[model samples]
Target: MSTESNSRGNHSAENGSSVHHVVQIDASFLSEVEGKMEELPRLLNRSAGRDSCCIFRVPQSLSEINERAYQPHIVSIGPFHHGEPQFQMIQEHKWRFLSDLLLRAESKRVVLKDFFEAVAPMEEPIRKSYSETLEFDGQDLIRMMVLDGCFIIELFCKVGRIVPADLDDPLFTMAWVLPFLMRDLLRLENQIPYFVLQKLFDLSVGSGNDDPSLAKLALGFFNYMVQRPLHVLVKYYEKKGVHLLDLFLMSYIPDCEEEVRRPSRFLHLIQCAKKLNQAGVRFKPRKTHSILDIKFKNGVLEIPVLTMDDFWSSLFLNFVAFEQCYRHSTKYVTTYATLMGCLINTPADAGFLRDHKIIENYFGTDKEVARFFNNVGKDVVFDIHRSYLSKVFEEVNEYYQNDWHVRWAGFRHKYFDTPWSFMSAVAATVLLLLTMIQAFYAVFAYQNPPKNH
Candidate 1:
């Protein structure tokens, strides 16, 4: 019995020993954890310095809807897409552009070393301009900035006619290539900081009293996107922007004071074009510089004519993605996109807008245009009450919800939607009135024989 008890005690001791060994942590593992913990403050500091970051990689949620909209097919501008395999062909052109810029700069006594020296001091701030930590080393980043910046400035100069474009230049010779390049340049990821471009432009081109600013040159280069009046471009040329994309976006924003209004309790989407038309809401093409300047008055909704093409689609998608990702950016483009999505639900709605001349659909069919808006507005989140178009939305919805308006509109649409239908209704009313008059006279004649004589 004593031996059996001793055996049980030994087994219990062995179990306890096993549990202790399992619970024990290695000294090396603790040291490694401590090392990682030490990195936390450095990581925090690095993140904190990224407040100036305006350029971003489009979020996966937004990009997955349409990857081509955010990606550059012709050229890679910044570190986000640098060294991409598809962008290799454009790299040769970039070097050629750089050579041209250098030749032009030589007359002004500026050299390659001057550009490198100018950008080297700005490497840290330039790196921080991007949302993500760039993997390029100091030298590589500086080289990219000089090379890319020079290419863009030179391209802008040639396109803006500040300098003559090479007669044999494929970018100019090929009709399709310049449009693609313009689209690529405006991409959110395909941008360097505006300051970098400014410095490079000033160095290479040497700004003069008569020489247009880089902003002007850029606007001129991208003018085909909107074809706004020269005065409009001149007005926005002096406005400061973080980058080229921001500059282009700023041009579209209306120069109106923000209205002081209480936030709406709940957000609402206005009805599509077809429903609105059915409800007697008239759509007129607004004559305004800003596309966001949509107005509602009485029973009419006036909207600026929007040209929908592949370039505009890509431009708007990136604009919306930027507004969504960047906190400091105003949600003008996103709000416009959401409003467009609400107003175009199907091919019929698109067709209605097309008929009204509110939407110039260069995109395939009405169905494709509808799909474009739907895809753009997918998964987007914004505060409708604070939107620039909030009042427009509220007024439009209120007008649509009125029972009297709907009934009257329904009556008019059912009866007088066409000129022939309106004429028929008028004739029928006259005929009914004449018959009533004849019946009254007949009743009088029957009641009094003398009156008949």
Candidate 2:
């Protein structure tokens, strides 16, 4: 485990126990997701739920937080603030995936065509006049990024024949590409940038397949496992009373950043320890996906930077920084309830549950989580997976009014007993707004003249 102390050499952990980090992740916890076959129905429920999400295998490092205690009741639902939904959520469950909903949209086919026209060459800086269709001239930066995305998904999800014997096979080199690609990825806008990446591919076999996006997501997670949390790695080692930050980073950081393969800005994180030391800040061991609970507060403020490994994790880190780093962070508001869910689950499922108590422990209480999820619609969670199926297959009701999602939301709500399906629907409603905008623009253009300009 590479850590911060080793890098700073001889720095003392004078008040180790009191270092209350703004976050805490049981890295060991996420690995247990494969065994979560039972928790799904409860989390994806359409009604008020009381299923305990307590995993049997959490690291003993921390005690089980008393489940947020609150009376379950009816609550109203609302829109998705989350980025594009993941493909895994689609292929495994069919229409439940947002991609399918996107498919159901009126201008879906056209939008997809537009998406392809803007993206499809497997090569980068696509030849403006390439006679061949779907073929890129050569690997451009975008193409390289797309490849990296595929490469990562191949590592985390489609890792064929990756057994215990090959888990550490240096050849895979997932870390090398993760940070390099992500740093560049952050430089652009979200949806449009993804549109470009999507267009560059030729998924003739499965036209609507979003395997690349799934790959991008998984790689994002793998990168977090490999890097960015070195400071936390240091804290972890410190807890065990052994320091190895310098040696660990020197040994693996270079490989993770792939400075040997391709020089990148990521290398600076590894080589620039002196500057961080001068500034007197270092990342503590990862508590929960790079978020940790620090007890020691010696006036050293924690800064937030996106960790290339986990998209959700990076978002959570920034979310915490928004509270801890911001000077205006209200003194009354120490932690938000949803942060706990983000800490415990994937980015997609943040506050998606119908039960509020499950998310309130780290955040504050059951009521708070319910209020947050209520802001989005209910369709995201289902009691039996049946509602999910029904909602996903339903045609995009074009006749529905602007607040139709809200209007149709009647079953038990999130705040009280609101139906989870309607809530998710509301969220989908907002995300799908762009399509409506495009339609309006097209209609306006057809009606008005270009006027010989």
Candidate 3:
């Protein structure tokens, strides 16, 4: 009887423990469901009021095309890629930059603490600008803004020649690093708010006679990297940008012309430069630094010279990614890339542009240069009707579509495409010229007979 009672009691105890475990799990799941249910209304409200997203993840569809171009290799700029293990190498450099900035401001008695104070209050507004709610709390986000903003200012200062570089500075002394850093800084996900940097600039370095506006400084830095003059965009300096990436985007747009209306969608498969050359379309190099200054008028297609090197892909891909994520942003860069892709379908097309001085290929082969454009627009969806290049595309396509243009192109390719054929044509021209001169002399002698006198 005692054994039976003990067994029964043990069984009852085991059953109770099992029941308790099940109840606990049920309670935890119910709590989670309730929490999500409670947050639905607030989430909807937040979604409705969202205006612009400063930083964005490169769309996975585009990223999968070439992950390296969308991702940072040597450095990560902002909070999205922050704490990444591979990017940790640059964190020390960022800290060093921060230290240098503090020391430079020592005379003004500005410390790191001052940066924190300025950034902390602006944290909420800054967060509001991001499309996705950040996983970081206020303190963490502020710290990131402070550190990243200072690093960028210091970099721009160095690049803009506003300040002298310290001895053994990696950014100045290590040549390869500058390109990577510049590429990384322009990534869509790799950016901090420009206002934070500007605020920090005022707090640490007063806006005095020598201190330039942040726009000027940023333009200077971009111009240095691109080796193009972006001074035309100085008028738009007072315009607000969400971050450094947006500032970079804004630099490409020229002031709107009153006469020209941008179309929504333009054709892409216009004749290549080589074909266009045959059709009597003149390719002239525009001396402007604005990348979007492509204009087609009266058979002349004016395009700014584009330099292609190892770093161009990284810089360009990031710009396209930004256009992809933002609805309100203009698709200028995307349109340009698509146009280039259409125009440069092969090495022959790239060589034609290179010969015309419209494209300056720094170190890449013609095929590689051609490939850059051909692959750049993959997975990026754009409405041609709303594109800045729509009008240019329409004009170019219309011009190339003429019956005369096609016949002329065919004539050139058949008769004058090869060197031997061109030489043959030149020889025939010389012979014809001699014959015409002989005929003219004979006629003159017969008509005048004045040579005898």
Candidate 4:
């Protein structure tokens, strides 16, 4: 009995001892975690010291609303959309374009290896250009850079007529493909670095490239994409562009003048075209091709002619996204789009612009154009203070808000909206004038008796 009691006592003692055992944390585990925390700041400093990353994934705030807007519809260019199965068909065409480019370069003694070697050294810088670190190895990246660079250069040459068009070229032969390609190239996700293209062009064409500079050829190609017949005034400034979308944005912004001075603050509520018209304000299409150059003077708002097409919404949304993403980038395109959105609230407003020949609507009905302007800037955040047309908007809005302007506008709209109404107003004015003359004669005759003389 005593032994059995001692055994129970020992078991209880063993369990109590096990329960009180202390855990010892390894010093190495703690050190490793602390080391990682210490390394974070150095990593950030290293990234900051490097050249600013240019290419970026579309901010979720911008892309989440319309994921398709940033995606290429017809073709993919860079690593972001490289492996998508839907865009795989165009890879063959890119290779074809590269082959054609080499054939054309034969006269300049340029071979495929020369192009590949030229782009090899640029791989590191090119990878750094993208905001997100690309996960491609040296060989894969170099190959992508070479192929994409050649395809872009060849495209610009073909579109600008720098090289003779191939008879069986799909881009030229198929009428529907060109417009889609233009839209695809301008997409935020589907862009290669412009430097890559320029370098490839120099290597392939030597000094034989017709255009004086690569910028000129690129601007010319942009004009073709927009289908504008006028020559765009591209300043010979050394602004480094991140991608095709960046280039397109910079085309409208003038050098040395980043922001237009905002007019002094006042009631800035710009009326629609119909309202402005009724308020005795005039609308005229400016001869310039820059859509950002909207002006107002002497009750005349001179807006540059805008071409609206099937791709207008996609083009505009991407432009807005680019402006939203970049810090140094101006909100000129955003402002222009907002102004258009303000001016055209409905189909009637669109018709008013069309009647003034300010907007060429190649899309569909006025409603579609109106809706296009209204929705293009969805999820896009912009500051009006930075808009170039701040002053113009202020003036237009203040002018439209004056009590006299409102009354006159209302009167004109109420009484003179149609030809019959205008004629009736003229007739009433004439009758009032005759009545006043008769009354004056009666008063004069009764007071001075001038009739007797």
List the RMSD of every prediction in angstroms: 4.3, 30.9, 9.3, 6.8
The C-alpha TM-scores of every prediction are 0.90, 0.19, 0.79, 0.82
Off by over 4 Å in 1: 1-22, 38-50, 257-260, 263-267, 439-453
User: Can you give the lDDT of residue 247 in candidate 2?
Assistant: 17
Cα lDDT, all candidates: 0.86, 0.28, 0.77, 0.76
| Total backbone collisions for each predicted model | 0, 75, 5, 0
Report the Cα lDDT for residue 35, model 4.
89
Span of 10 residues, lowest total lDDT, candidate 4: 40-49
Q: Estimate candidate 2's alpha-carbon lDDT, on a 0 to 1 scale.
A: 0.28
lDDT of 2 by residue, 1-453 (tens): 236644333243453433332345576776576567544333223221112110111111211221111100111000011113342221232222223223333243433344333445523223211111222234233433343333322333323222122444433455653343332222111111222223322231122453333323323333554554444333322121000111121222111110122232221111111222223322223234323222113312232222222333233222222223222222111222222222323222323221222222344343543333232111122121122111211111111212444333322233223456666867777778978999999999999969995
Error of 4 at 397 (Å): 2.7
Write the residue-wise lDDT of candidate 3 on 1-453 in tens digits: 367766776787888843122223578898999898776342223532456455777777888777888777778776678898998878888898888789888889888888898788887778766656677888888888888888888888877777888768766788888878888878787877778888988876677777688877876776657765445756766665778778877877765431344442335547678777777677888977676789899878999888887667777888888877766677778888888888898999999889989888984899988878888888888666666666777888778767887787777777688999899988999999999999999999898886544
Tens digit of per-residue lDDT, candidate 1, span 33-112: 99988763421235434567778888889999999999999899988899989988889999999998888889999999
lDDT for each residue of candidate 4 in 1-453, tens digit (9 for 90 to 100): 367766776787888843233357899999999988876342122332344555667777767666787888778888888978887777888998898899988998889999888888888778766666677799998898899878877888888888887878877798988777788888876878777877887887654544446666666776766655544534632344777778777777643243555446552546678878888778999987577788888778999888887576678878887777666667878888888888898899999999999999998899998887777666777666556677777788777767897787788887888999999999999999999999999998888874545
lDDT of 2 at 411: 26
Give the winner by lDDT. 1
- The alpha-carbon lDDT assigned to residue 184 of candidate 4 equals 86
